[model samples]
Target: MADWNAGQYLKFEDERTRPSVDLLRRVPLSDPQSCADIGCGPGNSTELLVERFQNARVIGLDSSPAMLSKARERLPGLTFVEADIATWQPEERFDLIFANAVLQWVPDHPGLLARLVSFLKQGGCLAVQMPDNLDEPSHRLMEKVAHEGPWASRLTSASAAREKIGSFEDCYAWLQQAGCAIDLWQTTYVHPLEGAGAIIEWFKSTGLKPYLDLLAPEERVEYLRHYMEEIAKAYPAQADGKVLLRFPRRFFVAQRM
Candidate 1:
């Protein structure tokens, strides 16, 4: 939202990164010459790719300068590029195009997935993972708050930027159209978050970013206050004071024909 604070994002790094590890494990490849991490975001997902394909050319791409800076700092030897995934065109195609937890942010599922598939070399793999948790309470609260009161008009842009996760059936169909053998599945991870207001802090770097960014500084305070109020009611603390966040994500690995 506001230049993507990598430090804030890494606060829940372990939980956020688990999906990348899981998604990487499912990618079937013997030897990929080149790999790209779309929406790499501080290079967490790209790091996983590097580990799996030690000799491959692994490049991390992201729109956020701050995120890329942190990524470059963390992985100095790796190449990181600043580019929007929605419009970026690489000089060379990749053997494995891995986009973990990123496609949801981009629009036009049918076209975007097709374009990504095109970036793959013949027999290359396109692996993607995205949050499908919009129906969940935390995200519902985001929609509810953004649509209520004076914030609605101001939040329209942020709302539009989000809310574009097409159905899994639609994505699978698109991969089929692109001529790929696909492995698609959904995983629901109930993460145990510690400390007070952890859920609010969790989304600060993610789902809450757009809403928080659109609001004025003062408005953001009131906006997040209201959001936290709703989150607290929805996600009550356990006896040890940890909150369980049910994060559901969908994954697909398509091997191009």
Candidate 2:
């Protein structure tokens, strides 16, 4: 996949950063000395960490140069590193390893969670929030549309870009075996938007990238038109003529002992 488009992702900055705010509110740490924001796209979530832990040394890590550049520009005082979550090796540990909307893109949740836990100091917390809306209409429609187009053959496995993250129960079991106390929950946010076009722009930054990457410019235009038509059918406009995009997310805070 091409480097993440930081500008595209930040279009819905407020909405995209809302979950990070909620997740950070539950991090049961009084004074974490060191912190790392994994997949800290454009520093929105990383800025939250700095504000909440003013005294801590906060660093943002991401694989995308565009994102890291934006993040660095957003907060030049803090450290930003280019690193892949799946293969990152740090020279030192941290009191908080925050992964907001990042882990889903990395495979092997059990192993990945354990590895994150390993990076924390004793009593340190590993806080994570991941979109759990694969079964939702928006995503289901992505798969549906992917298969119905001439680009279907090339995009056959695009849906697999985000592998099944497994159930929250499975996540609990994994953390338990990793010797951590866990707090986990699920939430569905009904985000109101102008129309299906707004909805398309939202996912175009994240979930829709894999499919769009495989198509020609004209083919992408056609694919998006079909997607928009399906989205209109799936998400009815509300009383004020706006559509509601239901986004489900899973959050967990695991404290290492």
Clashes of each: 1, 0
On residues 104-180, what C-alpha lDDT tens digit does candidate 1 reach at each position?
88888899889999998989999988998888999899888888757898887886666467677887899999999
Name model 1 segments beyond 4 Å from true.
none
lDDT of 2 at 114: 91
TM-score of 1: 0.96
lDDT of 2 by residue, 75-171 (tens): 9999999999999989999999999998989999889889989999999999999999999999999999999988889998788899687787899
| TM-scores for all predictions | 0.96, 0.99
| lDDT for each candidate structure | 0.88, 0.94
